[model samples]
Target: MPLPVPDRLCDLPYAHLLTPHTGPLRSDERYDTVHFDGGEYTDQRAGGATFLECAFTGVALSGVKLRQARFNEVWAQAGRWVGCDLSESEWQDSAVTGGVLAGVSAHGSALRRTVFRGCKLEAVNLRAAVLRDVVFEDCLLRDVDFGDARLTDVSFPGTTLEEVRLRGARLSRADLRGAVSLGLPDGHQGLQGAVISSTQLLELAPQFAHALGITVKD
Candidate 1:
């Protein structure tokens, strides 16, 4: 059986079912236990809106801005967020699956125990974010920036990362055993407790040597 996708907020009985708002979303609105399905939003601004225990299914968001939004225990599946601004958002214990997120800016965000599975995230900016116990499984991450981020117990299994920037990122006990095409930026101090395969270690040998100030002679 396949994993169930998020379609409705079953926990909330009296919640509002929002059809696509057409224009920009109201700022600082608290949408608790709201459910959205197959809706389309373009160039909308939902900054500072609070989403608690919400569910979004097959929603299409284009150029939507959710900057400083708060999502607590939210679930999103089969959603497409293109060129969206999610900077400084806070997501806690949420799950996102089968989503396509392109050019999403999440700078200075805080994500704790969030899971992103089977998602394609391109050019996502996570600079200076605080991610704890986050997991990225079976995802394609291209040009994702993690600069100055704090990652604790973050796992990336079966994930392919391309041009990922980890400069000044602080990793404590991160798991990267199943990551592919991984390369750290100039400073490597961020990968202290990261778990990598032997092949990956061999591939990064030269960079490791350079970081250690060791000259290898054949």
Candidate 2:
């Protein structure tokens, strides 16, 4: 049986009714665990709801408020979340591959074991958030703030961190291979416990030597 598509929030009595197990739904209704494949959610308010095992591929969620919500094992591939507020939410074991998150506010949220591969995260605010075991591979992170956030076992391979703020953030055991950064005070200040290529070190050696007032005379 094909699931009913939601058209409006008023059509459903509650958000849970839009789930696959329940009856059909309108096209504009808010839902939980609703198979929203290839759909767009614009200017919706679904705060404090839990979406378990939901798949949202090639979807757009703009101007949405998902505060204090939980998204467990959710797969959102090729999705776009612009100007969405996901503060204080928990996204556990979720995979968001090939997505775009622009101006998304996830302040004080928790992202555990979440994988964000090949995504574009521009001006995304993750201030004071807790991120554990999160991997962001081949992503473009511009003007992203991680100030005072807790980061454990985070990896960013082949990613661009241009003007990305990581001040006062704990990056112990974080891998940053092939990451390019500008506007950083020094390479050592921004790269703590991060893996770097030998070529990168050789390129940065002159800068490090200049900072230490040591002259390399050959």
Candidate 3:
């Protein structure tokens, strides 16, 4: 068997012509090539389910158990998922736009080639997760935790990360060049492998200086 290519470029998801679906999201169920439009799947238990080539529009899911769920080639728009348990879930080639995810527990999740555009992720727990080639474009990630997580080739373009926790997180080629605000309340020790522009550095110099106990006299 050939070795796995780590640096291979990931292709974006194509337009899908899917079958309309109307049913409860059950555990261990596989939803393939289905479109969930204008559905309310709140307070449901869909642990260990697999969603492939699926699309969600205006879906509402609160306090849902989606642990160990698998998602591939999925597209979600304008979905409201609050306080959902999505820990240990794996997502590939997924795109979520204009979604509201608040107080979501998604720690230890693996997300590859995923894009979150114009989404609001407030107080989401993503500690110890592994993200590769993922982009957060024009998103608001406030109070999101990524402690001890491994991030590779992740870019946050046009995003504002407010009070985001990065303590003990590992970053490789993590680009924050286009982030409107990088609010790291945990200091800057875990950003050893990240790339930031000089302007950002200058803006954050005072914070880092305070953390290092260095006083600059003007």
Candidate 4:
């Protein structure tokens, strides 16, 4: 299954038409219709900023602080956001393609209509976050934490979730049917509102039985 392209790209402005964004980002500053191309920003702080209709291509962001930042109609591709502090941020109508986001602190964040395609997300902290209509297609999610999170209409198609933590997470219409691998370290209790395939359920029967204290003696 393929991921849907972001609608924001339909009205993408040309490079010359886009404003080049450089220098340090200020808090509460609103950036609209801007482009960040091949920029390397590390350890920068940009909390409480709002970005609308922006594009980030080949950008490298490491150890950056972007707490409470809002992203709308954003297209990010071929970017590396490692060790970023994105906690409490709000992302809407954004698409991240072929990006590598590792060791990100996105706890308590809210993401709506966001799609991650062909991206690698490792050790992302999404605890207590709220996600709606989010999809991970052809992506890799390893060591991701979803503790106390609320997910609605979230699906993982052609994605692998390895060593994910989901303790106390709430799911509604979360489709794991298309996942290549679903490795939930916190067990089935955290999958109460999720929808899985029959094959997946059979594979997890042992864990379910153990959770119920039902000893199955072969």
Best by lDDT: 4
Query: TM per model?
Result: 0.86, 0.76, 0.91, 0.94
Ranking by lDDT: 4, 3, 1, 2
> Could you give candidate 3's per-residue lDDT for residues 151-198 as a string of tens digits?
999999999999999999999999999999989988786888999999
Candidate 2 lDDT over 1-218, as tens digits, reads 11232333333334343354333222323445566666777787778777776667688889888888888767677889999998898988777878899999999999988888789999899989999888887888887888778888887767777667766776777766557543344345545565667876786687678878899998
Residue-by-residue lDDT tens digits, candidate 1, 1-218: 11233444553333354433333466788877667778898998889999887788899999988999999877888999999989999998788989999989999999987889999999999999999988888999888899899988888888998878888888888888888668555545567767778988888888889988999998
lDDT of each: 0.82, 0.73, 0.88, 0.89
User: Residue 192 of candidate 1: its Cα lDDT?
Assistant: 74
Compute the lDDT of residue 24 as modeled in candidate 4.
71
Number of backbone collisions per candidate, in order? 0, 8, 0, 0
Question: Which predicted model would earn the best TM-score?
Answer: 4
Off by over 4 Å in 1: 1-24, 185-189, 213-217
The regions of model 3 sitting more than 4 angstroms off are 1-17
- Show the colliding residue pairs in model 3: none
- Global CA lDDT computed for model 1: 0.82
TM-score of 3: 0.91
Q: Tell how far residue 50 is off in model 1, in angstroms.
A: 0.6
